[model samples]
Target: MEQPYTLEPYQRCGLASLGLAALRAEYPGLSWHTLGGHFRSSQPFWAAIGANVPGGYEQRGVCSHVTSS
Candidate 1:
């Protein structure tokens, strides 16, 4: 399948993960803390590398709903 946006493969994955985090925040039973922690622990290198990539650091998940609610 083709995506409407023009993001690269890794960028797509990162956006999808961020979207999942958004949905989880809207609904209960979604654990952003654990997920974020897991991602941090498992993909420390990826995060570091992403930071260096242009516009990579901005591709982060939003979980404000979890905290606001």
Candidate 2:
């Protein structure tokens, strides 16, 4: 789930939560994983949804991989 931004009038009114909820309902039992730097900003949301971050690697700021499920 990337940043759930909306137009000025629609910001911060639970739209993101509703979208995520719909996705979860559509894809039951599927594992959602996000890579490296995204982990930094999204950690809280992932934790709230019970996601687990197993490990990650960064190679000279060129290549990176982070597994969260």
Candidate 3:
């Protein structure tokens, strides 16, 4: 059965990390740029998630995308 969002146990699990690792494996050189400015309250959340990305994250600039290894 489908579970409710609040009842889901993602908080104390490695769900996010696992998902990231899977994506990295599927797309070796995948990367992305931020869209404008982030909400003040969400800055911390964004920082925390991308802090350990394999390539690195740049939350600024005008370039849309650059694909390479």
Tell me the RMSD of model 1 versus the true structure.
Answer: 11.5
Q: Which digits, one per residue and each the tens of the lDDT, describe model 2 over residues 2-46?
A: 544468798556565667667667986654543334446555554
Per-residue alpha-carbon lDDT of model 1 for 1-69, expressed as tens digits? 122233555663566555544665687463323333334443653455345343433324666665633
Q: Which ten residues in a row have the lowest lDDT in candidate 2?
A: 51-60
Most TM-score-accurate candidate: 3
* Ranked by lDDT, top first: 3, 2, 1
Can you tell me which runs of candidate 1 are displaced by over 4 Å?
A: 1-13, 30-69
Counting clashing residue pairs in each candidate, in order, gives 0, 0, 0
lDDT of each: 0.45, 0.50, 0.57
**TM per candidate:** 0.26, 0.43, 0.47
- Clashes by residue pair, model 2: none
The residue-level lDDT of candidate 3 at 22 comes to 86
Candidate 2: which stretches are off by over 4 Å? Answer: 1-4, 39-69
* Best-to-worst TM-score order: 3, 2, 1
Question: What is the TM-score of candidate 3?
Answer: 0.47
User: What is the RMSD of candidate 3?
Assistant: 7.8
Q: Across residues 1-69, which tens digit of lDDT does each residue of candidate 3 receive?
A: 122122255653656556666877898887645445566855565566567875444466656454343
